[model samples]
Target: MFQLLIVDDEASVVDSLADTLPWHEIGISTVFKAYSGSEALELLKTNTIDIMMTDIRMPGLNGLELLALVRREWKRIKCILLSGHAEFSYAQQAIQHDAHEYLLKPISDGEVLDKVGNLVGILQRERDESRHYERVEKAFQEHLPKLQGDLLADLLQGVKISPERLGQKLESLKIAIPAEGRFALMLFRLEDRFAELDFYSLSLMEYAVVNMAEELFEDDFRLWSCKDLHGYLVFLVTIAGEGDTQQDRQEHPDRAAEPVESRLQSMASQLQLSVDRFLKGSVSVLISRWGSFPLDIKRLYEDILLSMRKQVGNQSGLLIYASDELEQLPVHALQRLYEPPMLVHLLESGDWEKTHDKLTGIWSELGAKWADSQEHLLEAFFSIYASFSSFAHKNGRQLTDMIGPHLSDVTGLTPSRSLEALQQWMFQSLELLQQCMENETRNDRENTVRRIKLFVQKHLVEDVSLQAIADYMYMHPVHVSRIFKLETGENLSDFVLRLKMEQAAFLLADPSLKNYEVALQLGYQNPNYFIKVFKKYYSLTPQEFRQKLEAVEEQ
Candidate 1:
């Protein structure tokens, strides 16, 4: 409920207003009366006054003076001025003092009530907006972990953020990890035992796992944990040593190493034990070698992801430390095949010769250095096979369908154990891809043309933009337009216009419709443009076409 104060030098005016105004109807429960401005000031000190209505000419403390004092003391109190004189200076003073209303002395109760009602609305709105802000702040606090998790996930997925900008973000999000501190990343993968659970239950289990991790490492390190892009639980861990700054710790590596590594290993074991005991799930922890923050994070993530790939289905419940001697793969070795316009993209676009040449470049580079190593050979094989499988699957075919009986020999590590066998398998797979692209390209072009025609027919009276059609087919418009022209021997734009004109001709056969009405029916807004287009297509305007049709029907 809101409270109001009525102040005047004349006690009758104050008393009349206090007793007669409909305070409760406009959400005001109590009205206080004061005979002078000083009395009003005293009332303001004790009461939560929402509004104050006062006579301007009070003797001891005038209304404008009282309002100025109130503005200093209680800024929230909305003031209204009442006076016998209609002086320009008085109204100006009232407005300057931020009074809500200025009325001459003989104001009606309705006028006073209306002004107060508006002020009450302002107060209520302020309260509502304030409450909404508070609720939003509370929600942000509750979901801060998830937000931080998403940010960490993006970072691990190789999304770049500058160090200064990243530090600002960390400060704003209240994350405690230092921007340049040395840290380790760990990947946690849940075993088959917990895989059958629903997503929500699995999420709860993951949250519990993070909480257990926080508890385990809270004493020795700062942990920023999140689910990485590939659904692995990833943690960026920094040591929490006392009395030493990050620079100091970096300078004194000998003192920090033994204790920190031992603590991390111990904590990993405890985390696994806790999950096994409480959640009946086993997780493998793959820990990366220590690296500096922000810059090294993406590279570290890639290294750990490769490590995790090696232990799939064989190393559950194990804590594997990434090898310090492991060399970082050169950018061209893996990045070319994984990035855009890579082998898969070229194959999808039926660029057979380019796809073959790209693979040859990758193989030539790898064979130069790592040809004899079995592990390196397997990595190369899997990389090529995975990209091929992904492309084949996208084109509604399987890798087995392309490679046929040779799939088993290529996939088996024993047969492709030698570098020569691996090379042969790689080239053999490329040969098969080229052949499949040859046949699939023909079928795919036909299917694309059919789908485009169907889409055009379906959207004849609506927007049939080339980009929209390309989006529906999930290909670039320029590419689709080229393919359409190759397959249909006509440009896509010409096809659409022809179809629309044919539809317009069919609609023109109806005798009851007007020319403008038929243009609108064909999705054209300007009748003149529509008529010109109709003449260009059929050698007759819409009116001439309709008249010709009527003459034929009568004959």
Candidate 2:
């Protein structure tokens, strides 16, 4: 639908065009009559007029002048020039001003309708095209991140793609880095400070870390990063240009220029300091040697992973350079123990089955590869123990309380004495931990339901929305609703409504209270809506119900 304004020096002409024409049938929802060009401008300022019909002979802002002004300010509004004169000069001026139509006075209504309807069709087509473009742009923006992340992840995992295909993927994902460019890989592992956070909080902190990295590295490098399979943030960075000087060098020109490796190490240290200061979290960074893209990406990733495990094991806030010479190790590091969906995350999320599978994978890897090595055995032992201890402490329990005497002899290394002994202790401890967690979860659910009910009762006369209740309980609204329904077999919304109606019924028992007063006391500002809801529940209006109660008492 559209709105229109009819302007002329004579009021009769304006009223005739507004009233006599079939504007509504041509999709014009509103028609305003203006006696002069100035009046039409005022209406256009206050309203969204889609089509303007004005007389060319009006005094002060003639039709051609008004057309120029409208074209400048509101270019989308279609203008029609109506004049009594049939002179070619007026029509030529109207055409110069980009008027949509030039019609003579005493024109038939059918001709006017035909011209306006054509303009409306054009507007409709333009609107449809604009909306389609907006939707496409929105969808592209929504999926752009995932598309970039997926291609990078596949490349890191050594997914083979021809050079042509990789270039096409890069161009389509709008990645600025060339497929043939040299790049360095940086692996970042969040430390114990972030381990206590839940999955959602952890994801947010990881996003913060990436955003901070982008801000710090953007001037010197083009950075692309993704969360890898092993729960580490992997960054692919390439120097933007040789001309870009480091901030410190720009500040202190006399200082000797540093190599790219030293520059990266300094930047990584700055990132760690920024995260520690701003987000109150520690990050361990491993910087890889620069390598050619596509060909050396997978190897660089593997090298960095090895460097991280061997050089930065069980440590926090450490920055290691993979290119630096370090002592070579004879034994292979256990892969499954630190692989994706690691033991600690599984335990924190209370995924017992996955945790068991992870443990099994670790034990199998140890037996098949390093069975005779006591150091590998101890590595497995300490890793599992750390995960278990972290989970227990997060839940306000001690490791000894959950595993009993098995953990009591940590000094003797009793659990790591043998493969069979470690397996026995590991499974037993897992079973005991699972039982304790399951029992606690059940009790927690009951306690949550009780608290939700108590909160609803206390704030019954205030805002009792799900968001309000969730804020009070310090939980996600969806989680609160799910737990409430799971424990009570009733929807939280239905529970709130039922309690409100019940309280309304009790309040109505007082003969001296007005119906609106009772409604106000129960948080219902609209007495009529309250009466409708009360009638729906009780099969009678509040007034009728109150009268019935009085009748019953008199009887």
Candidate 3:
């Protein structure tokens, strides 16, 4: 309900206007009457007003003074000025003071009510719009976490954001967590990739990691995960917990290193089941040395990443390692080893014989570097396939589909403990890959032809129909027509007409298809109109055409 106040020097005038106006019908349910601006100011102190009416010529404090006070203290309250004298000076003051309405001498109830009703509509619209804006803001705030998570995930993929712009966006997104004096970090690794190796494939596991990290931390932490430098998913966990050593003590003052180790083991045991249920993948955790916040976070994350590269000796998903376990495997080292004789050089020089022999040597070299099972053999495959996949996809083909089928089919050619077999597998895979490339190119052409056929069928009945099918497909109609005619060895319109006639001939023989049904089935909107076209094409009305076909069949 809108509260309204009426102020005039004459007590009877203020009361009469307030009582006579039927303000309730005009959306003002509560009313206050004041004989002067001073009295109205007092009333305003105790009451909230949506609209006000005052005499422009009130004694001592007039409507203009009251309007000024309202502007200062209650800017939302709308004002209307009343006056007995019809003076230009009074009207000028009302206009300057932002009075919503002005009426002279003995105002009728209906006129006042109409003016108030107009103001009420304006007030309601303003309120509704304000409410809508507030709701939209609240919803954006509520979903900030999920939005921030998605954004952080994209950022960690090495999607570029300049440093200054990065800081501004971080602030705006509310992920710029208070970097207190100290920070703690943890890197999580998903251990197994051979089960199904794919970057897009592990979206479920990444979601699980974010959820689990939230539950384990006390301090609010912003998280982002990426395939680490070692090719394992390293969760860069940065926490603004106090100095690590002090914070660890605060967490459990009585526990020694031995008990802490036991607790970590227990935490790992519980976490393994949860991770296994969701990921169907292996995992490992590397906790960073406690240090300062944000500044120390990147370095700590790198430590955890380095730890992921040093795979544990067992197949278990959970592995624990400190910085000591890390063995740097930067590409610069490989560049030094192959500067004079790079793999690309050997391959591009048409040294198939040399490249084949190099593969045999690398197989044993990798085996010696890690006397583990053939699991590490996959690391080489992943590296080679990654580069090859990029090259293939750039050339509009995928190498994985080519290599995967052959690997699945020919188990006899599989490499065991031998380098020669590995080379033979690589060479054989490439040969199969060539066939896949040809098939892919052929299939692309076939798909284009099929699409063109479908397009022609959809638009054949329309009068202004050249390239209508391609227009619907958002392609150049002429391009579609040219390609379609090239592939089918006929004009696009001829193909469309032939297809329409085939349907027409079928309808002519089928006794069940009514005339209107035949028209609709062949894409005509009007059955009578369709008959004219049918008669033109076949030299008979639709009914006559069908009857003639029947007569011929009977003969």
| Candidate number achieving the greatest lDDT relative to the actual structure | 2
List model 1 lDDT by residue over 1-555, tens digit each: 799988886644664577546689998998876767766776677668989988888788988899999989988788898889999999888888888889886887898889999999999988877776887889999999989988888777665577788888888789877756789998899886777889999999999999999998886778998986677899999887745798977876755666778788888999999999999989999889899887788778877877777755466788888764336445224543453456667777877777877777667766677666666667777777778889879878878888776653553465348767766777787788778777877998999999999999999777675656777998866677789999989988779889989989988888787888988887777686678677877899988888898888899
Candidate structures ordered by TM-score, highest first: 2, 1, 3
Global local distance difference test of model 3: 0.62
Q: Name the 10 consecutive residues with the lowest summed lDDT in model 3.
A: 331-340
**What is the Cα-based TM-score of model 2?**
0.45
Which has the higher TM-score value, candidate number 1 or candidate number 3? 1
Query: Which ten residues in a row are the worst by lDDT in model 1?
Result: 331-340
Clashes, model 3 = 1
Candidate 2 lDDT tens digits, 346-427: 9998889989998998889888888888998999999998888999999899988877865545888988988888888888
* Worst-scoring 10-residue span by lDDT in model 2: 323-332
- Local lDDT at 104 for model 2: 93
Greater-lDDT candidate between 1 and 2:
2
TM of each candidate vs. truth: 0.41, 0.45, 0.32
